[model samples]
Target: MNTIQDISKFSSQEKTFVTIGTFDGVHFGHQKIIEKLVSDAKNANKKSVLLTFFPHPRMVLQKDSNIELINTIEEKKSLLQKTGLDYLIIHPFSKEFSRMTALEFVRDLLVNQLNISKLIIGYDHHFGKNREGNIVQLTEYSHLYDFVVEEIPAQDIDDVSVSSTKIRRALLSGNLKTANNYLGYHFMLNGNVVNGKQLGGKIGYPTANIDVKEDYKLIPKTGVYVVKSNIDGLETFGMMNIGNRPTVDGNHQTIEVHFFDFNQDLYGKNLTIELLYFLRDEQKFDSISALIHQIKKDEKTARDYIKNNL
Candidate 1:
């Protein structure tokens, strides 16, 4: 896949089939639209292009406050590239860009810059200043621009719209099962392993500590989870925790994973963790023995869940 970060480097073509969206998670619903883009482009003998924005529109509009993301830029690119699209156009969203009218946006960016032949969008997808462009405006422009327009219906399962918001909510609530189903894969977190106080080691469950560097990335509620950790190319089953070590009076919340039946030094390395199940809520144990007993049970549950399902 070719990534076009600047509009100047777009290299206008005779025709291209394109869709535009932020596509945060690139969830199953987004995949359906992308699959259509691919098929439509192939059928029309044109390049398949995805026009997405960086920093998310909300971040630019809201400035200081914005909800965290489901995937980072690197993660989004990786996922989108796997769908076999021809081109990925990343527009740097800004205040000036946000001010463009629907017609100006279509004429200058979509038509004039990229030379889109057929535009595909979701049923409720809107664009331009203040979301002024809707399907009606697109239809009107189709006649003038001499391009075709296709609207993909909103995807839903059992009347529930499959959306990024819903998936994020599920993840935040520690409902990994529902989140995974919507995402069409495991809910994953990528981070760098960092040094910790070795509290887990003292309790016989050594953990690999990870710290994520992201301004707007969602962190799940404090709990024990059945997780699969990827170190280099090796995959290991583990139980991960996202919370403060309450028993030891540790105040900072951290992400730590203890691999099942495995011991290895993973400090300073990057790792990806996939959450499979939510075991129990975080608690403050009365004593060290009580904490250890609860951890043992959590480990057993994680092990059993992974063995049976993962």
Candidate 2:
């Protein structure tokens, strides 16, 4: 799929079938809409276009700095690419763009700029200047613009029984199974391995400290999780800890993964860890020896789970 960062760069003369949304997680519900967009466009011999916004409209318009997203912009693009879309347009969301009136958005952008022939949208979707444009307004404007508006009814959308909000909630609450069920894939954490204090090494459980650069990415609840990663084309299992080391009097939270039966220098390597199961909540042990004993048990449990499941 061709990805266009700017809408103006889309100079295709072919009329397009378009759908617009943040499409945050690209969960099952969003997939249903995308499937229809691709299939219908193919059947009609038109180009399928997905117009999404960056920085999230809420982040700009509502000044919501604390809002966590299920997928980063790059992750969303990677997921959407698998849906067979002809074009994916990621428009920047800003205060000025949010001020555009509903009429200007439809007439100036959709009709004149995009050359959109048909718009496939959710049933309750609203947009443009305080979200004044609804399905009713879209239908009215389609007549003036000489295009079509197809609103996927609420029942059709709810058939998937999933939403970005639900996925976020599941992850935040350590309900990985429910979140993965809705996502149709395991939740992942991508980051670069960084040097640590060597505390784990002293305890005979060295770990690779990961630094996730995206501030808005939603991290799962603080706990020990069974995770897997591909190291040089080999699938490796690991146990990950996501919490402050209260026993060691550590102050800040850290994400550290100790790969099972694998030893290599990973200080500068990038890794993607996929969470498979929630092992247990992090706790402070009374002594270093106590913590080491628990770590041994956690390792065995993680290994057994991976062996049985995989």
Candidate 3:
């Protein structure tokens, strides 16, 4: 799939089939709509185009700073690429752009810029200044611009929003199974490997500390989890700790991964770990030996789960 960072930068005169949304997780419900879009576009001999906004519209228009996203920008792009989409256009969301009227958005961006032949959108979708553009306005604009406006049923689009909410709730509650079910894939954490106190090394369980820089990216409930990552083209299995080192009296939360049968230096390397299962919630052990003992048990449990299920 070709990814366009900005819609204005793309020079295209050919007509296209387009859909517009944040498409945050690209979860199962979103996939349903995208599938119809790609299939219909292919049947009609038109390129499929997805126009999305970065910073999320809420962040820019409503100043929603506390919103957490299921996937980062790169992660969202990676997921969308696997959907057989033709063009993924990520446009910057700003206050100025938010002020554009529904008519202007349809005329300037969709018709003039993208040369849109058809627009596939959610049944209740609203866009443009203060979200004044509903299906009613979209239909009118489609007629004026000589493009088709196909609205996915309310039930289908409602599932997309509902699933997004359920996925976040499931992740924050340590329900990995439910979260993955809603997401249609493993929930992942991507970050750079950073230096740590080396306390796990002393306990015969060396770990790589992950430092996720995106403040908007959601982190799952603090606990231990079974995880997998592809490092240097090789698949590696591991257990990750997403909590403070309470046994050592540490206060700040840290994401640490201990890979099985691997001992290579990983400092400064970026890693994407997919959470497979939730083992247990984090707790403070009585002593160093006690903590080590519990970790060994956790490893065994993780290994068994991986062996039987994976």
Largest TM-score belongs to which candidate? 1
User: Which residue pairs clash in candidate 2?
Assistant: none
TM-score against truth, every candidate: 0.97, 0.94, 0.94
lDDT of 2 by residue, 1-310 (tens): 9999978788668899999999888877788889999999999999999999998988887675688888889889889999999999999899999999899999887988789999999758899999999989999999999999998864223354577888899899989888877877788888999999989988889999999889888989999999999999999999999988888876998999999988899999999899999998889999999999999999999999998998
Residue pairs with backbone overlap in model 1: none
How far out, in Å, is residue 266 in model 1? 0.6
Model 1: residues with Cα > 4 Å off, grouped in runs: none
List runs of model 3 lying over 4 Å from the truth. Answer: 154-162
C-alpha RMSD between model 2 and the true structure:
2.0
Candidate 2 ranges with C-alpha deviation above 4 Å: 153-160
Which 10-residue span in candidate 1 carries the lowest summed lDDT?
A: 6-15
Q: For candidate 2, what is the lDDT?
A: 0.89
Ordered from best to worst lDDT, the candidate numbers read 3, 2, 1
Lowest summed lDDT across 10 adjacent residues in model 3 is found at: 154-163
After TM-score superposition, what is the CA distance of residue 233 in candidate 3 from its true location, in Å?
Answer: 1.2
Candidate 2: deviation at residue 52, Å?
0.7
